[model samples]
Target: MSRRRSKILVVSALAVLLLAWEGAVVLTGAQASWPFPSGIIRSGFAITADGTLLVALAGSLQRVITGFLVGALVGIPTGIAMGLLPWVNLAMRPVTESLRSIAPIAWIPLAILWLGVQGNAALFVVAYAAVFPFILNAAQAARAVDRNHLRAARALGAGPGLILRAVVVPSTLPTIFTAARIALAIAWSSIIAAELALGVKIESGGRSVAGLGQLMVATLYVKRDVNALVFGMLVIGLVSFLIDAVLRRLRDTLLPWARR
Candidate 1:
């Protein structure tokens, strides 16, 4: 099938799946007090009545961006360095790989102890999540630079710095961008986990301090409010989808030459 047809089919399939899910719940007479789809829409509006949802989202986005920047700032350069220099890679590989093995959440306790389980702690986890993709892929991208190109540049009397700037960088740029996109998703998730851990002081509908994730978790435990959980899940998925789409557009624009 054509790509366009495939996409259309996928979307239709998703709609069907959603309908089936709601229908199944009703058919089984589950205890889930699922609000009608329209009610869910109203609830979304309720969440955003005075912009609390948007504010919380913005805060999370800001933290994610900052952490991603931190990771890329350190990871890209370090990855490139390691990729270019065998000695550096050999010296640091064990440490770097070892650290990557440790899950970002594992550091939560220490992060809270040192930085408090607040915005900074969340940012730290996201930054930590962002780093691995930067370093690992950048190193591989650098390594993938053709030996022929290197030889040609050297034969033309180009120095190491010039060869790197003119050849190595351009060739490896796609891989770096790819790694950045992957890291962006990781950073987003890490920030959400951070928010869940630290909790947001969101005020909504004349109420006060409605911790976004906390509220979702509360609804989840209420047992009857399964619809709320579904709604929250959809919200998160929609946000992540939009983010990934934006990054894909950026990748296409920034590196039109990026190979599939």
Candidate 2:
């Protein structure tokens, strides 16, 4: 099939599926549980028009970006150092693995106690989520660097720092970068949960920011806003898919040689 026809088919399928959901709602006359598409569009429009959705989305983005930046900065270097120095890896492996096992969500209570329930705790969740990918990817990448490359660097009188910067890091960078994309998605989700759990809002009440989690909560509380919840989920799914597509594009750009 031609590309354009394939795209049309996909869109048509999705439309049919959504309409089927609407039909189900009508046939069952279900309230609260299965609100229809028109209701979802209305809720989405209401939130968007009032700017609650934008503020929530912006706040979420800020928290996600901060955590991802901090996590990458720390995790990459630490992982590289550990990989290069056998003693470091041997000593810290158990602890690192142990902590990694702890879900970032599980840390919410502790994070709130330590950093308060607001922005700091939220950032902490996102950062912790991001760091693992960097660390795991960096460690494996470092350990797997071609032996011949290291030997050649050493023979050229390159010191440890120089070798690490010029040869080792470069060798692992592409793979580490790819893994970072996954970490970023994790970080975004973590921050959203943190914000919702903490009940964060723009300027307290008065419309309030409306994250997907927050939207879900609102649906539960507002006594039959099922449409809002489903729409919010759709928004989250679209955002995530778009992010994955962007990451794929980045991978192609950064590793053009891999394509060959």
Full-model lDDT for every candidate: 0.77, 0.79
- Where is model 2 poorest over a 10-residue stretch in terms of lDDT? 200-209
lDDT by residue for model 2 (56-137), tens: 6777777788899999998998788777779989987898899899999888888878986556788898899999899888
What digit string (tens of lDDT, one per residue) describes model 1 on residues 1-260? 99999999999998888688667766777633655564466667676676756666677778788999999999998998899899999998999999999999678777767886446777789899999999999999988889899899999999989998999999999998889889999888787676665543321222332334545644544334655556666777888899899988988888899847
CA lDDT for candidate 2: 0.79
lDDT of 1 at 96: 95
What TM-score do all the candidates reach, one by one? 0.81, 0.87
TM-score, candidate 1, is 0.81
Model 2 stretches with alpha carbons more than 4 Å out: 1-13, 31-33, 200-212, 222-224
Which candidate gets the maximum TM-score versus the true structure? 2
What shift in Å separates residue 157 of candidate 2 from its native position after superposition? 1.3
